[model samples]
Target: MNENKTHDLEKERQYYTNQTKELLQNLKEINEQKELTESELREQVMARIGAEKQLQAAEKALEHLEMALKMTGAQMTELQEHIMPDVHKLREYFEQCAQEAQLEANRAGIMRQAIYARK
Candidate 1:
């Protein structure tokens, strides 16, 4: 079924694109925030690394399945549906962490200014 195969390929491509978009969106936001402390930077880096690993694993799984599809007719729909929610949660959690870190940095900056103004 050429049509079915074509459709599956399209879906797989779309999922990968979505993952990349989420990863990049969060990274951009974190980077644009003021300078982060060591632990804050580590948190962002860990989140980014986790996202990247997921993407790489998905890519590898897709490649393996593409090859196996010829022999097994396996479908990727199940994997896509199952993982989407978890990915969304992960993205949200990372965004929250970044926002918290940014807020803390802003407060610290304000405190520094206040102390300096008094001096």
Candidate 2:
């Protein structure tokens, strides 16, 4: 009877040992899964932060472009109001000079023809 009790106690101890090892393995798997989830969450957070920074930079660039457009419009207005009239006046002056030169050439040609006829 004493030998039977010792044998039963040994079996119980072996069973409990096996159960403990299985529980430990389960705990390790749970920890690994948690770590993987945390890593994925961290990666997602970093990606979101990068995207936010890019959005901010894009917003800043848009603001600069808008300012440049406004300045360009103002410059165009100035050119149209103040400088275009002078350019048009110069063009007219050049046209008038060209007309006068053409008239003089015609007069010279007419004089030459008249001289040739007389001859």
Please report the candidate that would top TM-score against the real structure: 2
Error of 1 at 26 (Å): 48
What would the per-residue lDDT of candidate 2 be over residues 1-119, giving only the tens digit for each residue?
99999999999999999999999999898778666655665565566556556555655655565455456766478655665565556556555655655565565556546544543
Tell me each candidate's TM-score: 0.39, 0.55
Cα RMSDs, all models: 32.9, 35.9
Q: Which ten residues in a row have the lowest lDDT in candidate 1?
A: 32-41
- Top-scoring candidate (lDDT): 2
Residue pairs clashing, model 1 = none
lDDT of each: 0.62, 0.64
lDDT per residue (tens digit) for residues 20-45 in model 1: 99999987776555334434545655
Stretches of candidate 1 off by over 4 Å are: 1-74
> What's model 1's lDDT at 98?
53
